[model samples]
Target: MSNSSNVTKQFSAFYLENRLYGIEVGRVQEVVRSMLMTPIPLAPDYVCGLINLRGQVATAIGLRQLFGFHSEIPQDLINIVCKVDGMLISFQVDEIGDVIEVSESEFEPTPQTISEDIRKFMQGVYKVSNSLMSAIDVDNIIKFLNNKLK
Candidate 1:
């Protein structure tokens, strides 16, 4: 067996509906406070809209809507702008958590019990103290959105 799975990585954590999730810290550009988003006509429900980040337009995604969560997204949510496939995409999360350093040995494949909708976007889960942190695959998310938009 290869030891590559034992590499350690840093993750930028966030919360949604009290559940913890994270993305690779290297992919995260910045986290910004909630701002007005201009809605796109005929856009998918998960597409929250677009935001002007500095001078660049970033597409904001409502993670709650994308994850099939029924709870309404709070207005005071934070935007985690991530670079995926060389494009800036913003994920609106309930709240920003901390930067967690996790070992690859602690990573586990997404559980079969997890909802299929969410499982698809997950890279895996890391066992954290008292909770599990789902690793979000930003690339997969972008691909999912692309397919949905087609």
Candidate 2:
């Protein structure tokens, strides 16, 4: 067995519907407060809008809608900026949390109980304190969405 499984990895945490979600820290460019977005006409429901960060533009994806959430969109949404397929994309989440470190040994396969909508995008889960953090695979999501749009 390889010792690489024992390595510790850090994740940027966020919340949606009171459930914890995370993404590998290295993949995250930065998290920022909501910015003004230019709405895209005829776009899917999950596409919130396009945001201009400094001089760069990023497509903001509503994680809530993407995850099939039905709750009212919160007043203050956070953006998790990431580079996917050489393009900067922003994932809009409900709230932001601290950076969390968990050993690779702590990683577990996605629970069989998770809904398929969410399970498809989750790489796995890590048990942290009293909660389990589902790791989001941003690239996987983008690829799926791209194929979906094609």
Identify the leading candidate in terms of TM-score.
2
- Candidate 2, poorest ten consecutive residues by summed lDDT: 141-150
Error of 2 at 51 (Å): 0.1
Would you estimate the TM-scores of all the predictions?
0.95, 0.96
Residue-level lDDT of model 1, residues 66-115, one tens digit each, is 99999766879999998777778999999999999998989999999999
10 residues in a row with least lDDT, candidate 1:
1-10
TM-score of 2: 0.96
Task: Give the clash count for each candidate.
Answer: 0, 0
